[model samples]
Target: MTTKPAIIILSASVLAMASRVASDLGGEVHGFGKRVPDGADVTFDDVAAHLAGLFQERRPMVAVMAAGAVIRLLAPHLGDKLREPPVVALAEDGSAVVPLLGGHHGANVMARRIAGVVNGFAAITTAGDIRFGVALDQPPEGWALANPGSAKEVMADLVAGASARIEGNAPWLAGSSLSLAEDGEIDLITSDAADAAPGRGLLYRPKRLVLGIGCERGCETGEVLALARESLSEAGLSPQAVGLVASIDVKADEAALHHVARYFDCPVRFFDAARLEAETPRLRNPSDIVFAEVGCHGVAEGAALASVGASGELVAAKRKSGRATCAISRAQQPFTESNLPGRSRGRLFVVGIGPGSDGWRSPEVTQMVSRATDLVGYSLYLDLLGPLANGKTRHDFDLGKEEARVRHAMELAGEGRSVALVCSGDAGIYAMATLVFELLDKADGPDGLRDGARRIEIAVSPGISALQAAAARAGAPLGHDFCTISLSDLLTPWEDIKRRVSAAGEGDFVIAFYNPVSKKRRTQLAWARDKLLEHRPVSCPVILAANLGREGETIRVVPLGELDVDDVDMLTVVVVGSSNSSTVKTGDGRTWVYTPRGYARKEGTAMTNTIPGDAA
Candidate 1:
């Protein structure tokens, strides 16, 4: 399950001591209200309750108290929800502030904001946050511990209450950017706009910015920050106004955690692991392992969500990845009373069409397409769904132009237009569902876009992938532990593909191969076979299934060594079995394939009747 970001606020003296505890539990702390002596022990229930209550109301609040008051008033509220406010306790000497709740959820955020007034540490807990000093819940919604080393300076600035000017659509501004100045005396500026007058805080909002991050298996803090810099440079945005950081979740403990937290001076939100399994919206023709597992969808969604305003549209579906797609609203305010119908809200669908045949297309997908005012996809994919796209505005582009298509789709959806992005086979399986989330991650467009975008609703439906169709055609070859691999090398390198294939082979797992061959990519299959031969016997059964649910469908079985590569193409699927596979040729020359259950002998008790009958 994905972990939610949290924050903790407490009084100052207690804050100094509790900071370690909060960080140990992966939280940040803020000290507020009265200050207490150092090393004082306090009960934390009341503070905890108040925070829970605040969260329930979706209101940003933090509890403040002194160290003595913590044990007296705060301790009682721990078990009950206290609106889940950001809680912070201050010390009498004004030396420290401790955040005890909602650390990532804003406790530390509140603490740092206050720290500027009092001149103290925000007391962030996570090792990466403390060392690099980042607030976990700041910006870049999907970045976590993947890069923990880069947060030092960012957190320091926030603690100092340095004036921060926001340039682009800042979701943290709530409804009005101007209101931010009123609430916190912060200034907002444009990317190219001149810096604020001396003594004023500056936040430069560039028209575009990207934060790319790379980390070790558990990424470090500095590396995460370095990657963020790289992405910002690539996107032509200043590092100062980076609104968010985006990265995979597996490295949540690495430098990415601190780097992004400090960079945005905001919380680091984590994406769903299943969602991150895929690639981002801008990526196409991903590597074989990417398609075989989750594709680029999650990365795209994380990027879009982090960059885009809170109110964005999920313009595309997950494609070739478990990752999702999203688009930011370019609008400036809430969308209301627009010329468009349906409450001026947008909608997103992760539609799945079973297999490639039109007959297998789900009714929901067909309905969504028919109701859509616009369509988005690669030219070939759009053409495939042309029948359902009559009268709809089409955002058609080349095979690899995914980002452009997503941007266009979000713009339309934000305008309150219903739209559907087409995907072949299941939208979730190497399809378009994940891209919708990626686009949403960075949706910080105009006011109309923001208002309607936040109102967008998203849904996903199930569909049959090629593996299932191929397996059924080949007589239940997928009944056991099986894995799927795409031979395509668009996004993944051949080295990674080889490793996965080798692992699956060594594990004695059944395998399904998709995109086995294309006109330009022929050697992958041959290479795969050679690798598999290293583990399995020459006589291993290989089922070649072509056009399984479509016309000209054919299923053939051959020995691993005897299989012919020329007979396979992009449309063909190969299911290679383990040593248990066997073929039974019927007397009539027809052949049936089967795998033994491996069941042993059965024993039972029997009663004798002959003796009893003779006696009777």
Candidate 2:
């Protein structure tokens, strides 16, 4: 489940309330309708479909609407409560906060939190949380409920005027109004577990255990997980009590460490060498070689001890599996996202925002941009991110300097900050993604790649390209075989570009031209147009789509003989159709340009291509 919530609002009136809630909760606001509201971080038209999609993605939602409306809309998608994320509904005027679903699984708590933001009453319907001041089944972070099935029964009795007494250490639960007494009618059991069943009452496991792991570069995930389980078994410790996974900062990008954290269902924290070195005295098995290599005596033990702070003690000695090590430390208290020090693995998303329109952009790209702590991109592209970059630290650059912009994003991500390198079109298609991979492929010399930048996690999200947006605007102009060529000779030789254009002409392919023209370079588009005309007919359609999917969008279709260079601009993507391509007037008198992939000739040019008696 995503920690960040999506605040969804229907109209412009509730936008103030939505933004206020977003400010307090650190969530992105989604405005639904034709024209996106000014303050919305994201926009969607179809509320039902969008909510279903968000629900399936397991994203926590705070819809600023009636609670009954939300319940009715999501009732069809609701099923097993265990897998659902929190879903809360808020009044349009910010007067009431209600958790419509997932009460025990965080909705109630989220509702209360939202209520605090608006100074409104939390209409928490969950009887347990209302009476006990906590979600009994869903414990707080760094803790787990072993016997969730017993919570309802236990809370029922407690709410029925019965008192309880704890069987083990649970300082975290001291604040909850669970009606406890010295000699209580019921019991609340706690254990540092080893697959043991509860003897009596509701069983809860506090996150007092820390799982520390160290592995060689590119270590197998299974091996690391096996060692963790083995180490836990050896120490007779419960994986449930393992609150956090700790590792050296150098291993921040290690897939094995992340997988082990997933296995324990805990957050992983990375410690710098200096921090780990300070914990050298607490290490059960300090190593000179480790100190020489990573400037730390021991990665596993030091990281574990450092996570638990001054009161922590090593409960399990360093255990090794071929290329990995594991150690356990018991903390005096449980862990949380706030209390845990040291950086987490940095994340870099090379995402394409698509042709300056929310409708054209993918949801994934928007989500990534919202989640990003920093956005690095050219000035115009950064402006295209709209409200998603509202509170983010934008590292904006000029039109040129692509290399510097990407490098800065990597460096920021290496500092454990989530960074998004924004691009206009598809990231992989003649964009900054290639530059990112090239930089990563370089040797890790001092002047080359930095250690932190090299170890950050990077992801590339596909965006609607200029070619796609142009083709879509011109109906099905790219229905047949197509090839794209960038007319700019800055990267490739002009001769090489001409050769590719000539080859595309010979192939009779629908061609999409990127970087067709610029202020200083206007002749390339005319030259390419003439080149394609040599192989295709003079009557062939040439689509000049300027500022596709952006404001003042223009789509001009002209025959090859009448194609004008002056009509195109730097933002234009010129598509030259194949010889077989044609334009036709639809029933509504709307014109469409399409290159048929021989569906007509193969079936004798008849509208019906099926055999006789075949179902239509």
Candidate 3:
């Protein structure tokens, strides 16, 4: 969604207009079914539900429908304007653009942008935007309003024939239409220091302050945050005036520094030790211990001066708590995200795509993948991403080399790149999550893990595993106790696999078999079937689910005695039900499987024909 907005339309007649707008704005077209156009990105059946869901998910939307319809659809969810995403209502011909909600937040900006693309009219209705050409509540980027409670009052005062004077060097305020005089009754002050406030006025803050932090590895979050607050308070600097939190690159994955950045709602940027060492001459409080540790004369003050450039100097010297250090510097100019140099500490997301289907993919996974700059996975798994992998730099390893791909992903992210180590199904369940941690456990020792690899943050996103998908596609075969076993015996010993299977058989657990068979490994699946028959009856249900959520998918229920190894493959998960499992024939001529969780025993319907065609 960062690249493509969701462009929703109702009919094929409007498809041409939608396509033009989509191309012009770099958005994807989503439409209702049947009437959905051939070139649409996605299609849905229900309009109201789809609109409500998109609003709930906070996806940026441009609906090609009547304003009343969209208003009625989203009016129930209009409480928090700050959290709402831009929702623009476009004319069917792409002529007029109206922002029904989130006008100042982002909708007005998007409306004007779209109108510019199509040479259309963007309806501006907000009084402050229309009269003064600015939203007092929402200032331009790199500027923060210190006293937001005064915005409504100041706007009203200006409307009622009051003149204001700007004391600071704010070009945006000077360019607005507010009445001004040499000495006016209302004061609109803009300064980086908190002490610049007059007796009574609206205080606007330029984001010129930089807070440079250096903390011990694995320090507590509260210690760094408290030191930051105390440093700003002691320096008479507003926290709103801070634009960046600078730190050394080695501590990029440190949680304490990140917590301080989050507290100020500012970005955290990192500098390598060499870069920090360059600013040693400007450091007011240089240290020899730090020089010996990280090859920098100082960390907190050196990073602050390095961030603010040569023209700026540190306003507050090195201030430290027990394990954390803090310093403040005023930049020569307000620093925006674009104007800031350097990169973030990289992140590696160990994601599970849930059987290679977009519909089965979680929203969290989709959002994270969109933010990734690189992807590392198998060729077929990367191909399954479809449109999501369009702009990504993919490093597709062959199916055999799992360790090689993980190593590649870690290295890329260690270089300050956003990387995703893609895996199929749940990454934790017999997948790459364990391998990533195992590598991290013995990192920077012998094998290929560099020292920077330890500085990259790792997050694991869960997905529906093969066993869960098979159980859902068939019935509830895993209602009570369930366990999974991989039969490949490639990395694991066959003796250990046999012991687990025999123990699970004694435990009466419904067994889900993964990696059922391969071309050369066909005997294990047959041996497991024969061994499981020793405990349960031959009539026990066994589900063979192949290609679970992808094309050419198949699900079959057969008896335990009739289990065939030829029908099972790496893509298939074979689930052998327990003794209490039952197979039922519905009136619709379809089959369903269920294992009673003893609810039927208490309800006195254990073996009764309560269902229409359930076998007794």
**Highest TM-score among the candidates is held by which one?**
2
Q: Write the per-residue lDDT of candidate 2 for residues 1-616, one digit (tens) a residue.
A: 2468889998888788788888888887889856455778889989999999899888889998888889888989998889888899898777888887788777887888888888888998888778778777787776788887787787787889998887788765677888889888777777777756554477778887888888999999999999999999998888788888999998998899999888888889999999999998777789999999999999999998998899889999899999999999988878887787678889999999889788888988987887888999999999987887798898989988999988999999999999999999899999999999889988365557788999989899999999998888889987777999999999899999999998998777789999988889989888888887777778888888888887888988899888888888888889998777789888997677998756332211212332222232
Which regions in candidate 2 have their CA more than 4 angstroms from the true location?
A: 116-119, 168-172, 193-197, 445-447, 586-590, 599-616
Task: Give Cα distance to truth, residue 377, candidate 3, Å.
Answer: 1.2
Stretches of candidate 3 off by over 4 Å are 1-6, 9-59, 160-162, 196-201, 599-616
How high is the lDDT of residue 418 in model 3? 87
For model 1, state the Cα shift of residue 436 in Å: 2.2
What TM-score does each of the candidates earn? 0.40, 0.93, 0.91
What's model 2's overall lDDT? 0.85
Instruction: Put down candidate 3 lDDT per residue, 1-616, tens digits, no spaces.
Output: 3535788998988887777777777677787866863556666677888788778878889999999999999888788877787799998877899988877766787788889876789997888777877777778789988887777788787777888888889888899998889798888888888765555568888998889999898999999999999999999888889898999989888888888888888888899999999998888888999999999998899889889898887999989999999999888888885788567888898999899876677766766676789999999888877767766899999988999889889989998888888888988998888888988988957784887787898989998899999999988998777899999799999999999998877666789999989889999989888888877778889999999899899999999989988877778889998767789988998688888765222121123322222344
lDDT of each: 0.52, 0.85, 0.84
Model 1 lDDT tens row, 261-367: 57665333334334444334434322344335434344534434433334443222222211222221121222222211111235555566565455566545655
TM-score of candidate 2 to 2 decimals: 0.93
Consecutive 10-residue window with the lowest summed lDDT within model 1: 604-613
Q: Kindly provide the TM-score of model 1 when superposed on the true structure, using C-alpha atoms.
A: 0.40
RMSD of model 1 against the true structure: 23.0
